[model samples]
Target: MMSKNPNLTLTGPDLAALLCSRVCHDVISPVGAINNGLELLDEGGADSDAMDLIRTSALNASVRLKFARLAFGASGSVGASIDTGEAERAAKDFAVAEKKTEVIWNGPRAIVAKNRVKLLLNLFLVAYSSIPRGGTLELTLENPEFDAKFKIVARGKLMRVPAKFVEITSGQVEEAIDAHSIQPYYTVLLAEECGMELGHSATGEEIIFTAESVSV
Candidate 1:
């Protein structure tokens, strides 16, 4: 899954396109399953158990699609702001949807640029990856103003950070970036584009992220 990085440099448009493709790739299988379930219902008549299973599967797929749309895809106009309430719901749903991590958001309701929400969601995934079995991720905001500082704390029994992901975020391993490591790399790029600075630290049982406005 090599990214189209011309001149060995990933551009904004390249990352955007890659993320869009990634989300689509993830949602396609579940969506296709839902479609298949629908076809089965049409042909098989009223089967209660089968209908119940299909309903649950459809709901799961819908939740995932919504989460992917908010987290990876563009939510609105280029410079438009998104409601933090909506972002919070999407993040919580996404975290629970995976059934691997539980998220606790501690912040006030405030509007921020959609890019910041995108960065936040990407950071969530990074933290989620640290936990092998299951874990708790706590996202906190130091300030809920237009230009705010946020922190992400993830804790689990086994926490492992991938070197490639760290390197990509630091812009240290540009040539090694592929579809798997692109999210972390793109998170860093998007943060900088939105005038923010991002840093991460990891311990044996935890990984912490700190992001603040560069304008500060």
Candidate 2:
């Protein structure tokens, strides 16, 4: 939906605000359910049901927070690298939070640059979006230390790539950036900043996202 635009402009504060809103949007539902469960218990409704809701909602909140931390937070100082094992846990947890996607992580347990991990998480989110009817998210990193390439396959009963999502990821957006598009936008930004080539395509029921490091 979008072509490469090196000047996809967004102010630093605005991007931060939108991404914050996006993270809040993701956690609000589960957090609200937690509050609802508590109120139900206060009303003396079926304690079993209330407790179940509270427990599940709490776990969901925890999972989402973990994913957000890796996907959006500054994990460390400059030049920091994250362990691939940790990235795998975040990816797997995010899929669980969605309740319909399964994550297959084949990346090594070695350390990878922070930007690389962030881009990986964002691509996982993109693939998750494509599979609306529950699916498998197969993510891989080949040769992490040198000639690194990341691949994510999204396969499902029903799959779609939003025109806007494609536009943002491909760096072709001329419109104002909003929370809906910020995730992909950030993914592309990270790829560009890290000298990683970003691309995506769909085949039959599968949507594939890839990023490859480019030599200087």
Candidate 3:
């Protein structure tokens, strides 16, 4: 769906800036915890728990940064391929660190273009939002040799598509989109930019997203 209002339509740079702000906002908490841990260590009477805090905080920051590098940053040069294994590992690590989701990659380690990888990661984020009470995020790739197809399924007790997702993807919103809803809105743009079509469905406890490549 396309927006009729020019004010609601976002430019590439404006969307990119919002995504960057979202990533930085997410990273600041863990990074701040690391800094606080360092202060605790430098002060006297630091215990083993302080060391543990520092270790955990560092790991959290690292995992989130790695995942964001692929999901939100420029993970590769233009036209370069990204390692699927690396992307899978990053997603799994992030899920484990968050402790609210379990990411399972049921696909081969075939190299995919960076844009495709970004599209996958963005879809993963969409699925991630569906499960508020922790869930399984199952990622699968089909027909990798030809027109690669990717599916992300989220299953949990309270899995549901976000209202923002419907508004942004279907271009049905009357209000301007803010930072909180920009990620899903950006996911739609990224899919279109990569010449991929995104489809959404939900059944019972599962919310699924499927993306397939097409000629630009």
- Top candidate, metric lDDT: 2
C-alpha RMSD between model 2 and the true structure: 2.7
Off by over 4 Å in 3: 1-8, 42-46, 214-216
Candidates in order, TM-scores: namely: 0.83, 0.94, 0.89
Off by over 4 Å in 1: 1-8, 35-49, 174-176
* Number of colliding residue pairs in each model: 0, 1, 0
The most accurate candidate by TM-score is 2
> Taking the tens digit of each residue's C-alpha lDDT, what string does model 2 give over 1-216?
232455457778988999999999999999999999999999989999999999999999999999889889998898899998888998887778668889998857788888888888888888788888888989989988667899998899878886776777655677878988888888877887778888888889688889998887
The per-model lDDT (C-alpha) reads 0.75, 0.84, 0.82
Candidate 3 lDDT for residue 141: 86
Error of 2 at 146 (Å): 2.7
The CA-based lDDT of model 2 is what?
A: 0.84
For all predictions, the C-alpha RMSD in Å is: 4.2, 2.7, 2.7
Task: List, residue by residue over 1-216, the lDDT tens digit for candidate 3.
Answer: 664323347887888888888888878998888788788878854768778887888888899888989987887677777888888998899888888898888878888778788888889988898898888999998865458899999999878898887776776777776778888887877777677888899999689999898864
Which pairs of residues collide in model 1? none
What is the model-wide C-alpha lDDT for candidate 1?
0.75
